[model samples]
Target: MKSAARHAIDLAGFEAKFRAGPDPWHTLTARDEAIKRQRILRALGDGPIARILELGSGNGSNSQALARRALKLHTCDGSASATQLTRQALADAPNAHAWHIALPAPLPGHRYEAVVIAELLYYLAPRAMQRLAKDVANALAPGARLVLAHHQIEFPDNTQRTAGIHDRFINALGRSVTKVRQFRSQRWIVDGYRA
Candidate 1:
């Protein structure tokens, strides 16, 4: 199959697998992430900070955590149901904005204190990756912080190998890459990039 078709199949498989469990992975994953997410959230700083945005705001777990701190928080996802869950979960909270965005598109506006994109990049094809990266980097202010977590390569495959190498290449496209010492279920996290 072509790479794009392969990715589509992969995503379909993911949807079916996760959809098997009606509530999906976000909840259990969030509970597992609770402690480390605290560290990530704290790194973004305790605000009076105006705004924070979370990409792939799955099940609204992490976004809700952020709404507690930021003056205003925006949560976005490509999926309508996911965005709906985000809004519903955050409805009781005051400082929350939730939206369903079509990916590979530029963020609606720039200037945010921090952005979290957890496990979102690999879903895009390589062509889309560059566009997405450009949009993300351009959307940020010079020193705006980004938190990027990836698909856990618990065991490697050719695609995973390419993904790792892609990270190095993408890192160079921006100013610098720094490895963040953190744990999200033994997966790696990278923090702070000019990109």
Candidate 2:
């Protein structure tokens, strides 16, 4: 399917899913999600992050943990309900804020020390993915890191294949992004890129 066509269809599907309830991907209860979270944290290392951005923060489970470590954390999701759930989940975390954003749109105005895209890339179409690559490149501060994690198995709703999604970013960023770490499991692949 074309990028725009797929985006429209997926947006409607996702909106309904978000409206139904948070944790659409069951991140809170899934063992794989937990492992993915741990791997991402490990990839980020033990450095004190001044500011971080988490794209497609589904239910804020990861956001809550990241908020504890960072001085400031901003999470964005395409679904309004998802963002609301994220806000509620991180309500007591003074440093965290969740915003509702449609995919392919511009990121927040501030540059980030670390940007995370976990289990979110495959859902984005080709055009949106290009925009994301450009936006992320522009949004990263000097020596900032971008972590991308995704399920290796293709899903019906996925607009792009897992390898293709990651490859696009690697190709777009080129020498500007350095591969910091990579971990692969039977179900998921996590890669960290520093710019």
Candidate 3:
């Protein structure tokens, strides 16, 4: 009961923060954020991805970056304000599409060449994370890549630790996915997997 209430409060807070400020996380100015984005971009490489789905793309910062490299980019978030901000930020990018959608929900029928989930997994409950892993596997095209990145440090809003989250993700993925690369800094951990 307490957990459920806290979850609702957290979701509301995310929306409120986005409505009040475009850079709720200061992703636009943070050096750590820049480094994390650069590393994810490097993992994506120079090749043009056919389709990319980015979950929890606050203000479309990372989505805009990926839109430049992808033929089509779908960025989604639970917060309406965040989605609106993302749409506004990516308005110039013809390839990007920003939508408001909650996590652990049904994915589109089509598969994607690449999918990125950054700084969002820990917010989901354990069951939701399990469902997400399956959804990610199903949404990936053959030999497609999935990038999972999360903050290593503890935070008040997180539902699970980074290590536990990644462990469950890999467990849920089972033999269907293979890890390709991993990067760890003092602040964050990023892992790339192939399906």
Candidate 4:
């Protein structure tokens, strides 16, 4: 099935949502979020990662955890407010950096040992998602890992369901990046791939 054709959320919408309140998604305290975080970390494994890029810095809750495992961590989000929160959350981690980047754009030009994109893809339209998947595939170093997490439930603003989003990425990534792990709950899905 084709992904949804709805327009992706614009920068203003993200800014307003972050400005209205912190933790708008309850990522900091939600039980499911916590579980997803743990699962993502487990998928990344115990080896020290030289560099990690996180595409969606939603309040930086998950970014904080990734920072601990990576020697250098770069995280970006579409909203300035969300990026600020991520910076604050990673303040103590000298190796962590945050940027406000509207996505469906090119990824940072860096070969990373690992990349985490959580709760972000559904916000993008089909073509945007395809572009991002290609960018992500290019950014990953040989033998690098890519971890994706998304909620299973549908939202009115989402341009795709979790499966569609994941499938698009996997297809765009091609045959070289193989799936290494998968975790599914009633509300969420996490998939790990190795390049």
Candidate 5:
């Protein structure tokens, strides 16, 4: 399959969307999105995560929830506006920090107890995806958790399906990573792994 990075929406496109509206994807009001967030949290469980790195900080809805469960939450997005919104959402939590960055690039340089990549992997090309998988594996501390959530449907801008994205991470992480939790529905898939 071809990489979506070649033709998928670029950083400017994402920034424009965020600039146009606070909740471009209706992340706060969408039923499926709510369900997806719930599933992601459930997969991560109720324990306290010392450090968390979230790859996509969409309007900070998920980030806000994650911040409550983590001692330190670092979240980033390609859109500056999104990052601003994330910061606003997490204003009460001094432990949460948001950065604006173009993804498919290197992740933040820090080993984390947990990492969450949600609704963001399909935008990456195979090479970028592989690189990210490697980065994620390296960033994970021993016994750390990696949680992934992606929509199952194919879209024009997406390079891979949910299953394909999860498989790529599993393959890249090799035998050291093991599945800890999973949830699948017609709309989306959420998988958790332990390193």
Candidate 6:
């Protein structure tokens, strides 16, 4: 319960800043997100993905856009308000499921062709993040893809602190590793996937 409380605080902090106004970093982050999401989905080739799951949908801009094209989707956040705002913003996409999910659980138990996670992974504690990565890897079906992005620096882990072991452990999995963008100053979105 203590860990859950702390995770909620992290989510709340991001949600609070998002509620403040249209943030430029978020704007820049959105641009990068769009490019990566498109590239990955396209790279998966021409097919409408059946089921979609997202770890942090933020304002739901990405989910709304994806759902319009006819894909079933579920998105969750640690912040209740994030879910509230996402539902409101995504009213147009009736099939997109929005919920609140705490960390280190079974995770969203639905195999997906593609799993999308944006900048939220870095906020997790190292051990918690490990559980998340493994859970996500197991949740994906063969030929499935996991799109992960983070505010990466030259160091490992995140801006909060560098944890190379965790980062390397994630990299060691059977996944493609690459750098995405630097829209938000020094932060880079690193991607991993399974063939």
Best by TM-score: 4
Q: What global local distance difference test value does model 6 have?
A: 0.61
Give the candidate number with the greatest lDDT. Answer: 4
TM-score of 2: 0.91
List pairs with backbone clashes in candidate 6.
152-188
Per-residue lDDT tens digits of candidate 6, residues 1-195? 331122233655666766775342463367665665565454334567777787777667566765654378888877666677678777878778888776556766657876777666656666677777777767776777566555555333232342343354355343543333222234454454544
Stretches of candidate 3 exceeding 4 Å from the true structure: 1-9
lDDT (tens digit, per residue) of candidate 2 on 1-195: 543333333767877888887777798989988998888887776877999999988778799888987899999988788888899999999988888998668887569999998877778777778778888888899988889988888665677877667888667653488888998899898888888
> Compared with the true structure, what per-residue lDDT tens digits does model 4 show for residues 119-155?
9988887787888888888899999999999988877
Q: List model 1 lDDT by residue over 1-195, tens digit each.
A: 533323232444444544465357555366556665665675564455576778877667777788887777887877666677788779888888888785667675577766777766666656666677776666566556666655455322222332463364355345443444344445545443332
Assess candidate 5 and give its lDDT.
Answer: 0.85
Compose the digit string of candidate 5's lDDT tens values, residues 1-195: 864453467677888988999998799889988888888988886789999999988789899889988999999898889999999999999998998877767776579999999988887777777778878888899888899998887776665655577887678664487888999889789998888
Question: Could you tell me the TM-score of candidate 3?
Answer: 0.91
Off by over 4 Å in 1: 1-22, 26-30, 46-48, 154-185, 188-195
* Model 1 steric clash total: 0
Clashing pairs in 2: none
Error of 3 at 24 (Å): 1.4
Candidate 2 clashes: the total is 0
Lowest lDDT block of 10, candidate 1: 154-163
